[model samples]
Target: MPTQPKVIFFDVNETLLDLQPVKESVANALNGRKELVPLWFTTLLQYSLVATVGDRYADFGDIGAATLRMVAEKNHITLSQEAAEAALKPIRSLPPHPEVPAALRRLQRAGFRLFTLTNGGSAALQDQIGHAGLEPYFENLLSVESIGKFKPHRDVYNWAADEVGASPKDCLLVAAHGWDVAGAAWAGMQTAFIARPGQALYPLAGPTTYTCEDLSSLADRLVD
Candidate 1:
């Protein structure tokens, strides 16, 4: 039988919370130009990685606002810092995906130490979990900002293990993103890839310990 992890570290955005609200907010912010929503999000993720790769640290919210403004400029739109911040303000209150709450409860009941290790900033992460009513579901909410790097960086993964007081092998990272799964596995932790729609494992990485269509599917295996 495959060994189960004592600690299960989750990626917050997209993995746990539904980002459709952010899309809706951005649509309204752009005067119904929903087309810019995806572009703005992509730019946000891109710049986050850029900062990480450059060995610099910036809060997730700050990077998000900067990218929103950058994307707006690229498209010749006038997006002020206030407007960008307003658009992203919805992130802190995003609702959990339908399957997430139940699945998380199942994992906790099954005796797993559930924790959140997000690339999001400390204040934003606290607001997200509290607003979603998910604060009690996790033992601890961790952020990579403490380490000055982002996901896919080895430091974040190893640091999470240290915080949890577990060896990397004793923890499993659950995430919807390929890079996060790949990073955890490479960082000496086991991984479970939630194969969310339009997401696929990276071609360069080896297989993970588990791959499921959603949180419920993963819970079905992890929880009796």
Candidate 2:
């Protein structure tokens, strides 16, 4: 029999929340060049990793703005401060995936403690949760700010497990990113990979103990 988790820590972007609209917004802002969105996102992740390795940190919004400007410049596009700001405007208003609310509600009702661990800063995360009507579902919001690191950094996962007062073995890390799962698994937590479309698992060793197509399916597994 599978052991039930004492706490479940979720990844925000791409897991519970859909980032497609934000990508589209950035693409539109970049004058129909959709490729810029991925470029910016990759840069954002790269900088976050650099911060983690260098023992430095910047808020997600700042990183997003900086990366957008860099990407714009690289593409020979003139990016004003206003335009960079506009590119990130959709971050706060991203809609939750259709299955998120129901899955969260079901998990809450089933007596599982829920928390969020995201790369997003406190303000951005708060705005997103409020906008998505998901604030009521999570017991706590754990940001990378607290750990001065990003996902795939073992310390962040350790911090989350510690904050919830659960041993890593008793908690589950749920995310759409295989790197995140790999990190959490290495940190001793069980992992659930949400096979969200457009994301792929890394061909690496990790504790990807379970897989689900959506939050609802994951919730069903947990409750069962």
Candidate 3:
């Protein structure tokens, strides 16, 4: 049997929060080209990795605005810096997935220590958690900004383990991004992949310890 984790780390963004509002906002900024939102998001993530690889640390929000501008420029849409920032403003107040609150309650009741780890900056993370009323759910809101790297960087996971005083192997990372699952696994942690729409596991990575359509299902598996 798989060992039960003593600590559970959740990735923020699309893992716990629904990003549709932000997507809609970006779509509007793209001149109603809703189809471009996904591409813009992809570019945002891509540049985040670029920043990490180059040893340059920028807040996640700044990366988002810059990538939004890049996407707009590529598609021949003129986007001002202020407009790009405005489009990403919804990220601070995203609603949780319908199943998130109840699922978190179950996990907490089951005696698992929970924390949120994200690539967002400290202030942005605080605003997000507070605005979503999720502050009470986690013991801490950890950001990669502390270590000057992004997720999927081995150092970030190791640093997170140190922050919570837990051994990497004794913790489980639950995330909607396959790359995140892979990173945690590589960093010597267990992983649960939340198979959100349009998301899939990276075939090149090792198998995830658990795969569920949503957090409620994950709770069903974790809570007795």
The number of the candidate with the highest lDDT is: 3
- Cα displacement (angstroms), candidate 3, residue 164, comes to 0.6
Model 3, 79-154: lDDT tens per residue?
Answer: 9999999999999999999999989988988999999989999998998889878888788899999999999999
Model 1: how far residue 212 lies from native, Å: 1.0
> Each model's TM-score?
0.95, 0.96, 0.98
Error of 3 at 107 (Å): 0.9
Q: List the residue pairs that clash in candidate 2.
A: none
Candidate 1 local Cα displacement, residue 70, angstroms:
0.9
| Tens digits of per-residue lDDT for model 2, 1-224 | 45788899999999999999889988877777996787888898898898788888888888888888888888888888788888788989999999999999999999999999999998889999999999999999889987778888998999899999999999999999888898899999999999998777788754487889999999988897
Model 1 RMSD, rounded to 1 decimal? 1.4
| Cα distance off (Å), candidate 3, residue 88 | 0.5
Pairs in steric clash, model 1: none
Candidate 3 positional error at 62, Å: 0.3
Decoy 1 TM-score against native: 0.95
Worst 10 residues of 3 by lDDT: 128-137
